[model samples]
Target: MENVKDLNHKPLSVKQYAIVSSLLFGLFFGAGNLIFPVHLGQLSGAHWVVAMLGFLCTAVALPLLSVLAISVTRSKGVYDIGRPLGPAFALGFMILIHATIGPLFGTPRTATVSFTVGVQPLLPKNAVHLGLLVFSGLFFLAAFLCSYKQSNIMTSIGKLLNPLFLVLLFATFLLGFLSPMGHAASQTVTSAYVNGSFFNGFLQGYNTMDALSGLAFGVTVVTAVNEMGKTNPISNSKVTAKAGVFAVGTIGLIYVGLVWLGATSLGKFNVSPDGGVAFNQIMNYYLGGVGHAFLATLLTLACITTAIGLVGAFAQDFHKHFPKVSYKVWLGLMCLASFLTANFGLDQIIAWSTPMLMFLYPFAMVLILLSVTSPLFHRDPVVYAWTVVCTAVPAFLEMISSFPPVVSQSGFGKAVTTFQSNYLPFASAGMDWVVPALVGAILGVTFHLVLKAKRNGAVESEKED
Candidate 1:
């Protein structure tokens, strides 16, 4: 029935489409996106290509899949994705997702990390706290100005910030490649990557944390497509998918380059503790004193675009569900919340948010997969409900296990971990949710079919009678 209403419209021109794609890229590719693939390259060494292939699946592919999931499902935002489960569940899902990806976690982390990596190193140790306060205040002020008008977000990020960033970044890549660090093929593979480079890279993608943002960002992408004049469901899906492909495909290429940069740098530097350090090393090796400024600028550009996209998305989605509160009010609230959190409570914020991320990621992944495949199951409530309940058990376990050591070392935490590790496949690895989700999907589909057949049989008997 929903399929019958897919009207037609002209698609966007090449330039318009490219802008939409750039908006998506600007929204999703933040500091973490830069960090993970480079770290993977360092670890995988000679196997960087193989590792990046798997990394692409979860990093580049998963987010694009989330965008398509929104498009295909005809969901206006994350709120609609879980609506099949029930309005109450859908509302809760929307709030949790928006909160997790909004002020409580991802948004503030961008500011916090940008400060720590780019600006803090320049400040005296005694002045670090004051520096964070000043930076985050200025950061949120800029974010608020950019996103206060929803229409400005795409232009500010896509038409302006993204192109400039690409220019600066590609210049770095060119310099690194042209000069001699050493070939990645000859670098020594770290032990974990020497064995299962692909799997390790797949796991590395989880660190980007873009999948959750992708689901949240459905609102922005769909809004941009709608503004571009393709409102029909079919056309909408097409534009969204194409934009996602361009955005994430470009990201995949960058990942290849970033990882390769890391692997080759091993020629001159030991494996660093994290990608931030490795990235700095690359920049310093090439540009010396000037590289620090370039890095700070890059981090600020990458992160602010992300902040603008997320703040706008949060406001738009919340306003959609609770219209009594205006969008601008919600936007201001998020900016204020994140600014204060970034400046004062960042460590605590991270501790709490890590567990929430672990908890929410599985649900987001399962919901996206199911929404994309719902046609096969006729969008049945049973399928959604059963899969969700089954998945919840392991997801909850994973969340508790990810709690900070003080919390995770509790008796209750140990009990949860013991149960998960003893029984669930890949439980210790934070991936056990996958198998249980599959089982739940199978169970839901089977029961749904059984009920359908019985109802059909009853109808046939009634007709004969």
Candidate 2:
């Protein structure tokens, strides 16, 4: 029984806490965080408030909870989250997470999004692809250079770029609100959001995938706390929690402002194809010609900082696993891969990434919840394994179902979808895993208690002998 109260050490002063909080916030606030809320606000229209609340549950609350879980468990990184399952599972899970947030999806997205919002609006329509090719080439070159030296990323992004980004973003929000853009459109709620705006917003937040990043970022946060002289587990955990509060508060305020901007743009601007377009429209309306330059600078800074962080984290992790490969080589490869994928365009990248997000988000949530509540179940591995297994099944099914109609209408896909729809509660709401996860957790706790009782009986019998 490691008592949390007994583990305390000296805490960080207010100034030290603020610096770490800004770093964590910068890490979590990036391209998707900016885009998703605006799109949700647009679609939610008059229901934006409800949608925003729902988004906060997963976007704001879950990531904050993830940071706390990391501190409480003293996890070194994302790998530690799955380590209780076994080495193979741990490695595989980590690889998937890194890949999802690195070259395969997240890293590419940053490039594509920056291009769409920052560069495309300025380019001639005929030269869009060529512009992307040239821009992404230069974009990734910068990211690779920055990420090559991971030590400087926090100081550069947190201390310099994040504040500038926040100021510009705050100005945009202030101007948009003060000038107004008519009330939210009276448009009928979109189909996905019609019945369950809250749930829809909850699922929409999954697109940000910050929860996964939070797990990966645990190492960064812990390292920062240790650097600040908070070495004990309880002190580290408390410091991390406090920093997480500040970070999420900043993130939450920005989200609300962005959502408001989107909601108000309803009748004033045409419904854009994606959030990036909507955001650009809002900026242009608020700041005129200066808005384009402002948006370009903001998007580039936001995307590059995030890209640097992801590339650095991915390269470092892989280099550790395959020591023969140098970190610099891994960083170069990741940046190159991301560059190529980014040319696929923002819309395509988002479409492809959604299914993967659907598959992984629930599993990430399950891990976070179990880790934070581990003490109640005596930190049993059986509990972790069962909960993960239960969550993974439905998550896999949902992923399959999210594929194109060509694939989803196929024999096996149809069968899986039917089974899920008929048997799983909340299947339609994209949360079919919830009940099963809860059930599995209950069973694991039962197993732990029974095993504990049996072990005590055996020990008592041996004493009698």
| CA lDDT of each prediction against the hidden true structure | 0.86, 0.84
| Per-residue accuracy of model 1 over 1-465 as CA lDDT, tens digit each | 335433335546899989999999999988777766777888888999999988888888888889888878877788888999999999999899888878878899789877877888789999999999999999999999999888898789989999999998899889987995889999999988877888778767776778888888988887877777676767787888888888899998898899899899899988988788888888889999898899999988999999999999999998988899999999999999999888754466656887887788789888988888988988899999889998998889988988998879999999989998889998755688889889999999999999999999999999999
lDDT per residue for candidate 2 within 141-236, as digits (tens), equals 998887667667667667887888888887888788788886764644566777789999999999888999888877767766666666766677
Error of 2 at 393 (Å): 1.5
Assess candidate 1 and give its lDDT: 0.86
Q: Provide the clashing-pair count of each candidate structure.
A: 0, 0
Task: Name the candidate that leads on lDDT.
Answer: 1
Clash list (residue pairs), candidate 1? none
How many clashing pairs does model 1 include? 0
The parts of candidate 2 lying over 4 Å away from their true place are 1-10, 185-188, 231-234
